[model samples]
Target: MNGTGNIVALKPFPDAARLELDDAQLRTNLRRATHTIRDKRLRVVGEVDDWEQLRLSGAAIKDDVLARLPELLERFEEAATKAGAVVHWARDSAEACEIVTALVKETAAREVVKVKSMATQEIGLNEALEAAGIAATETDLAELIVQLAEDTPSHILVPAIHYNRSQIREIFLSKMPGVTRGLTDEPRALAEAARKHLRAKFLTATVGISGANFAIADTGTLVVVESEGNGRMCLTLPQTLISVVGIEKILPDFSSLDVFLQLLPRSSTGERMNPYTSMWTGVTPGDGPQTTHIVLIDNGRTATLSDEVGRQALRCIRCSACLNVCPVYERVGGHAYGSVYPGPIGAILSPQMTGDGANKTLPYASTLCGACFDACPVRINIPEVLVHLRQKGPKSRAEHAAFASISWIMRDRRRYAAALRAARRGSAPLRGRGPLRRLPWPASAWTVSRDLPLPPKESFREWWAKR
Candidate 1:
């Protein structure tokens, strides 16, 4: 959702994907980045002797959380309140944004520093804050790059994964104010430039906005795992901190962090452990934020939770492993999906979380490759959920009529034989050849990158009768 109660999609997947496929640079960047991460993840994941068992444990813990979501949310609110953090519940993205905007206004701060937050992005919090005349500065290096370039994130973990070093250097030189001339495209140089740009914002901003990787119900703690120190700065430096988290991100207790912390870093950044792991419970007197607020955002998660089969998507940990391993995402990149979340996980979760309007096409974005399922640290059966969403989703009149016709023809033996006879005659020109390079209108979409198997000259029924 785009924080306005709207399902955000500029166009269907096929249309956006077609445009993205034509971008040679995007395809090249995605191929290189995803493969590098995929190889590294495989190497690190191989180092764990009990990886599969850990995945099972993670999935079980998440399932239990989903099953007991309501109870846990109340428990979390009570604990956070007791710990001096005000807890607010938002029924949707609009309400969440409203609550956060009001909270920032109360701090009387016209500017806010932000950590890398998928939840905020999902609800368009930056735009909301911008409308309120509050400037939200992204402190994370990749997020800063994306913000400077005025682009949406294409990858979950790495917001600027679509850009190469040279591209980033160009963005910083042009968009980042006061950048020195002749800046190099070296990784260290780009990082140093970003660090300098964000350091001032971190020190001056009074309010910070963030999303949690996990929210522990037992202690009302929020956990953020990151490779850079930016998250730490955002968490501690601000006087007023407001965290907007999804309800599904909640876990039963602090112990559950044992399994997820191990799973998240390995799957996301391909590290055995993140460089920085920050956990905050309510307000810590004179330590972190003096005033703390936790906004628990439902934002259609309850609807997603209502679906028996689709609810499995709630088990996601935002690791981005599914994206790195997905062939379709590798080709099209994240912008084509047109959501804050993208890749295989987005293919299923987007439709369910926002309902099957513009995002219904996402369910069909995959080749049904099981790589995403295999790569998921929590073992969320993504392929199964994709198929389930498609089966239960809307269909165009043409698709409905075509299926109806096929079913009618198949129901009668005589009609079925006649259909096969017509098919052989219709396919006669291509019968002796290899896979057809192209087909007519509706089937043309399928044959664009693939070849269809030519129909046989004779039906099996006809051959049997003749023999």
Candidate 2:
């Protein structure tokens, strides 16, 4: 990715959201999924005795890493090289893709099995591989479904989250090779279908590609936390293994990882611990992959790290907790964000990563409710970053008009009362319906993406007059 390169074309938030808002099915899927995840996170997070302290510790550690990132990168490179793992530094996405492609070609592998990787998605690696005539198979079930459907991921944790099981059944039956029409949408049946589809690819794949959740600088170890066993297979089964890692993923030591292991699961999948947490240091001669490679990608991270306020986004562990709790995300879904990274985190992170471009509009995608901040295990202060980025971008016409209207309304008691009377009259018809979902013109800027409580049928001033 370049200074202005977007992970995906981010149409202005309001415009994209207008289209997403019209999709009743998408809204329903997002609401149900986010609420379920949010409730689960609250349940598991409540069990932790020192959750706040853990968040503080995690933030402090990441801040430390961000502070000394250049030094840590060198230390990590040296340690990883010493452990007999080849280390490659990529300045941008194109260079990183070229390096990985060259590595795969060296092994003469035409097909590679891939573990779900956000970094790879951000860099458009699968597309790059296809351009090079190398097939990249997504082993993650959601990823596979998206691939089969020829659709982009709409969420972080569950890429196919926008697709209901019935939709998935249709996709599998139509696109999945050898899938029987008898395949039902039952969770087990879907899992079985996907398993059978991917089993051959996993067993026969000569090269495997991945992204690291954490990279230990001192030990040259990489960690991947996953709910499914696919990542484990990708890490161990191939003759050659490659990991594309963001430079910020480097942790100084294993002791630092302890805090994160405790926080990430409860915050991400709402589990006490992951089903499969894979860790490896380079390679052992006859075990795992004899040839292991870790590509440290800078892309736009150096620029992002330079910004004092925005740098906090680097601390994100991709838990998706912020996404689950974000009202804006719950309604419009990740597609509206137009980034591999999405939700409240994406609102702040993508703009910084992509520089001054169409993504500049991303900072305004949030409601700034601070639910994201509360849910964040690492305490990234996402709302703060969103505000910081918004200040850097030019304000939208709707924002200016809304504030100007407020200024006018507050100037006189008569004006204010008239405005309130109008609001009450406008809401009277829909008074018992629900929250105000849409409003006229500039006001739609607020009500389009989020619902507002209906105005009171009678103003407090009217009651005061009666009294």
Candidate 3:
């Protein structure tokens, strides 16, 4: 399942970032979008007087859920089943995919409409469904664009964030069936076109699949908060409905929504609240889908939970506030991280979710600016986790040797003075040179985009002795 998932980074983050950085247009798009969202979030978040207290409460709730996860999961299953939902457990991605595909096939449907779901993406569910001859159509406007363009999602909340209006117009005109050639790049026109395109799918699709923003163990309710009504349609309009949820998504009770429902929308879309918040309890017989299934997927979550510091990543509500504020994410974009979940969260989450074999370099992809933790609604200390994960990674021989030499020198006064004297002599020629140009190998890497200031002409000990 890990092998089959989208968590694997095809290349190391540095190499991927190097390639992504060359795209000026991409950088421009990312800067505009992230800044807009960042400014909006700051404004709305400021409106709440007790925002910090709310963040603390949200984190405490999620931590408690993780601590009692085993019991909470069972309670959720029991309550969901009692409410007429068929709850299924999946140990990994493969099992989750198999379970969903089988459920879809049981409805005798060739096509299924979907609400945007990170868990489904994590399992590579669409690709798996395709292999089984079932078409999983993404009904969300942004997801549909990415799917039509054969592109992976670059951002958590805005999947098509990398694409500008003109590019989106081109995609719709070229890829969308029955779309008018005159479709303009205006936001309204694009929304209209997508709405018309998805309307038929929503009406006729026999199966719908979704991921929950929250699953309440107390009442067996699954909640999805979105700006568009597509999620509501998916929740209501189908012969059968299935939801793929991560075990971490569960809350101890229905009241937990009071905190998250407030935090998620504001932190994600910069909205005081989402326009559409859809909740369902299993099935409603003739009113909605007759058959309801909930597949709770582990897929290495247990492994992630094993970590003391890293377990905090599971608290992510997918608000993506961190992505909108991250400097590295703004410049290089999400594709560089090579995961559906990107930015500060992905750098920590993706590595622990899969293993050391995949995304080995992700932990290093940060400035440790601490912006992410500040933006996080649940207050995941992402930089702390990133540093923790970095410590767990394979040590660099050159770095280890360099630190070892420094340690050895610091332990003895003679070596320290000798090292200082050598440095002073080597830097004398470059003194008052402002900043040295790119130096030779090893040091060249640091000097490429940064200045290397010349050291003092004499060591402190030498100056004292001469005086």
Candidate 4:
């Protein structure tokens, strides 16, 4: 996958948010799902005595990897080539998509079974493959649900978190081929329904596509951490396997992986350890896939790396811990962000990826609440980055006017006092109504979800001068 998918083409965040806010059912689902995960994460994370230290270690390791990415990439290529895997480099999303599509065509296979890969989604790989007349099937349960419904993923870990069991059952019964009648919304029933649908694709697929959780540079072993067994199936069953990974995913060695292995599961799924962890070092001849290919994608990562303050976003493990604890996410949910990556991480990461173009409003989507920073396992200061991006963002005419007005007023004490008296008179109508629920055009946007406080009867300056 590549950078194209991350370049969101939707309404500005506030405009999109207006539609999402009216959906009461989405709010209930988001609140319930986020709270459940947040509770479980607290329980599992508390079990580790040195969780804070582990976070620090994780941050330090990623920092080292980013610092030495070029050298490590060279080292990783050498080891992977020796291990019999072909390595490809792509400077951007278009190049990455071309490389993967050509590789799939080389095998003469029309269908590829895909493990759940955010990297592929970021590049819009499925759409690319479909355009090239190759079918890419999503094998993960939640991902399959999203694909079948033709809907975008709403969460990182659980992509279909927006859908309840009933919604999922409907999607399956309507879209899933060969789905049996009388299918129930029961959890077991849903799993069996999806399993039956994907099983045929798994057996007949000749090519497999995946994204690595971590790539060890010294040994060239690519790691995929997953709860379901589907990732293992996709990694092994196919004759040709291709893994697309971001350049930032590489780590120096196995020792660094030890810290992340512990940090990832507890933060992502609230498990002490993942149910399945698939690691392979290139081609193993008759053991697994005979041919393996690795495409390391730069996309916009180099540009993101250039920003010292924004570079901290690269430390993310895609844990969704920040998403679970975010107040804004809990209220409006992921789709409103209009990026594959939503919530706090998306707020900072998306703008960095595409710059302040279509995604400029993303940085201002937050309330500057520090919850995301606190929930981050790697301790990325997300709020700090958000503020940094906002300062860097282009200012609107209204904002410039407002700031200019305040600046001018503050330059003179008499002007400030006169402004305060005018505000008191203007707010007198609001006193009878307690707080202003709605205001005029420019200020109406702010009052849509909030109310302005009533001004005091007399100015503090007036009372002080009289006293």
Candidate 5:
């Protein structure tokens, strides 16, 4: 695979195998978690009479923001610079990684605590930092579990959804340093264990790296909302803070934060309010992070913005509600998506980020059930985008050819009747069984995992004529 290119041939089955072996446990955890959150979200969302209107308004705001992203980004840079933040622009993941790595090296910080940042993950920042001899410790409880297990985040919000409590206990017992010899599969125990491990890092680390949930252009303020206080600690305790955020993450002003603050928490963890909603503008002397640097990353986001239908994905607040509702995502989980963003959002976002060609299969991963569209807080029409991409996809070429051939066959009624007669004659071999016991080659491959329905003995037109 190219360093920054999409992993087109990446199989979901391998990651699924690891998950399936612990199927009973994962099912129990997911069932409990998803049901609880689903109920809470429906209840809270119902309280607002204009919920649909709010969704439409949110989507419109994002569309408007994306329309003039270039202008707004420059405005953000100017404002942030005025507020004492040093702004660095990176065109791609490599440049972003290099900029972050160089910044950390210049600070001479060997260890850095991290708030859960998807941009950092997208650019492989931790790996880059490690290569530069910097240890990046993940502070989020789920992220810590993922980092310790050397596993990739399956879901954007819940990174370790693939791991059950017992699996987490196994990981802690094996990976966490100075952890108790025996660990139970209790949530409280796991959280305390993580807290002990990360508290030391938070107090001692000189630098912190984070991704903003939203960046306000008007005041140059960066926002991060999380259920855990660990993000707050990571953002505050470190002396020097480096935030890697996508340029597309910028909102026009601070007022826009109200719409997202309401949309994100309820949609994500199903909370009425997130425990920690942190916002900071540049450097504040005697406060959180005396030195602040924002690395504005444009890695494929600009390319995604250029796309008409696919651009709506940029509006995502990284709320994983769509994932929880997607049947395919519910079964295979996020690892199968093979990108930093996963599930329905990832399907549309990944192909757009990579540009459609050989990696077009990402769009087809959905069943087009529209469950994701219904669940999306921002009302991203995931099914519409999926079909749009499919039409522009590589498979469409073959489909077009098939259509032309079928059209040619159907143009002449005599040929069509002869074809149906041939079909009836050929299918005579399987008449007693009602359908062929087994097909051959390509046709057989379709039936390998499913049974084929028997064709009618007579054509519909012929039956109509007889009547």
Candidate 6:
């Protein structure tokens, strides 16, 4: 994972152009994945009579935690250290990468097995490790697929949701050694092949790197919740375990853990309870890892927190429920967002963390339909934040100058009416059943997809006056 600042600097234009061309395949993959998870989520959530109340509680708890993040982080550091875990604080991505790289180098390990950790992806840890001549293997199934394909994750929970079965089979045949050449697109065959490939790495690796779903400040316990048992294996099998987590992931106590444990699984994978929920407080004698280190990263999170409207994005648990429900994401897919965090969350989050320059186009990608807000378990008001970012966009000096000229012409009734009349006249040559056939430059981008309505023969004000 690269820093949010650098990662967000790479916007959707180049990626989106490619994704839009793959519309059919994206639709098929998104329809299959989203429909399955959406149905499961609704069923499990409906089982709880007070689902709305639980959502409210989750939102309130996160808000309270964010309000006191600095204090809670200090408390977490104290507690973790007391439990024999070395705590490292990183102010940015470069520092975090440097710390992790140095630690891995100290162990003199060339290869490390990894559990699926979004924090690692957020910082481009694998790439950083590779740059330092260390090999980081992703053991999680979806993450493995992503790594093998040399593609970025499309969804938070299901990194390969954009890939169909055939695509996956092709990836395996090309990447995995000893994989059956005649593999079909069956789920069982694919899973078996991945299992076989990862087993060797698990047994041989001396060090493991992971990201925690939550870090408890009270007892200094780190929690990882997952559907697969791979995380459990990675945490325990290695002599050295390094967990890199976002500063925002800290919870006040085990009591607070009860709320997230219940909410996260159901919201994310639509599971009643996660199959593997691993919790460890430092290191145990002759058990798991003899050495444990926790790296708390604050890469762009503090900057995002400084903005009142954007702060709510920090509460995201990466459930990706919002992603599954997002219409734009369903169509364009995650790669188009050009960030580790994609979909609805990425749209608002990327621009704010990176600032509104070229990346400013992301927030405008959505229709502001508020579907993401409804689907988010923590109740992040995505639509509000998106609109807030849009307001920030036109205020840029370059943007203001462009719109300012247009504003001047549209200010007076006569000038506006004349402009509309001119538009109607110009569109005469493009007369069709619907609207104008073609538009100029940047505006043509919008017209390429759907027809732009031509100006009416008369303004509404003129009709009203006549009446």
Best TM-score goes to which candidate?
3
Expressed as tens digits, the lDDT of each residue in 41-107 for candidate 6 is 9889889787788789888889888998888899999988898889998877778889999999999
Q: How accurate is candidate 1 locally (lDDT)?
A: 0.89
- For each candidate, the alpha-carbon lDDT, in order, equals 0.89, 0.88, 0.91, 0.90, 0.82, 0.85
- Span of ten consecutive residues with least summed lDDT in model 3: 1-10
Error of 5 at 343 (Å): 1.1
Better of 3 and 6 by lDDT: 3
Cα RMSD, model 3: 1.9
- For model 2, the stretches where C-alpha displacement exceeds 4 angstroms are 1-8, 396-467
TM per candidate comes to: 0.95, 0.87, 0.96, 0.95, 0.91, 0.90
RMSD of 6: 3.0
Off by over 4 Å in 6: 1-6, 9-11, 394-433, 441-451, 455-467
lDDT of 5 at 407: 92
**Model 6 weakest 10-residue run by lDDT:** 1-10
Clashing pairs in 1: none
lDDT per residue as tens, model 5, 1-467: 12253323255433443554466666666666666777888888878777787788788888888988888888888888888889998887889889988988888999999999888888888898898899999999999999999998888888998787788999999999988767788999999999888877888888999999998888888999887898899789888889999887889998887788888888888777889899999988888888889999877787777768877888887888998888777766676677777788888887787753334677877789998999898989999989888888765565678778789879999988988888788777677675454778767755764677665689899999999
TM-score, predicted candidate 3 vs. hidden true structure: 0.96
Per-residue lDDT for 1-467 in model 1, tens only?
32223336668998999999999999899999999999999999999999999999999999999889889999998888888899998988888999999999998999999999888998889999999999999888999999989899999999999999999999999999889777899999888898888888888888988999998889989999988899999899989999999999999999898899889999999999989999999988879899999999888787788889988999999999999999999999999888888999998878888854468789989999899999999998999999998999887898889899999999999999898889878888766678889888899867987888866887787789999
Q: For candidate 3, write residues 143-199 as lDDT tens digits.
A: 999999999999999999999999999999999989887888999999999999999
Per-residue lDDT for 300-351 in model 4, tens only? 7787898899999999888999999999999888899888889999988887
Runs in model 3 lying further than 4 Å from the true structure: 1-4, 356-358, 445-451, 458-467
lDDT of 2 by residue, 415-459 (tens): 998989988887688888878778897668678667899887787
Off by over 4 Å in 4: 411-415, 425-432, 458-467
RMSD of each: 2.2, 4.5, 1.9, 2.1, 2.9, 3.0
**Highest-scoring model, lDDT:** 3
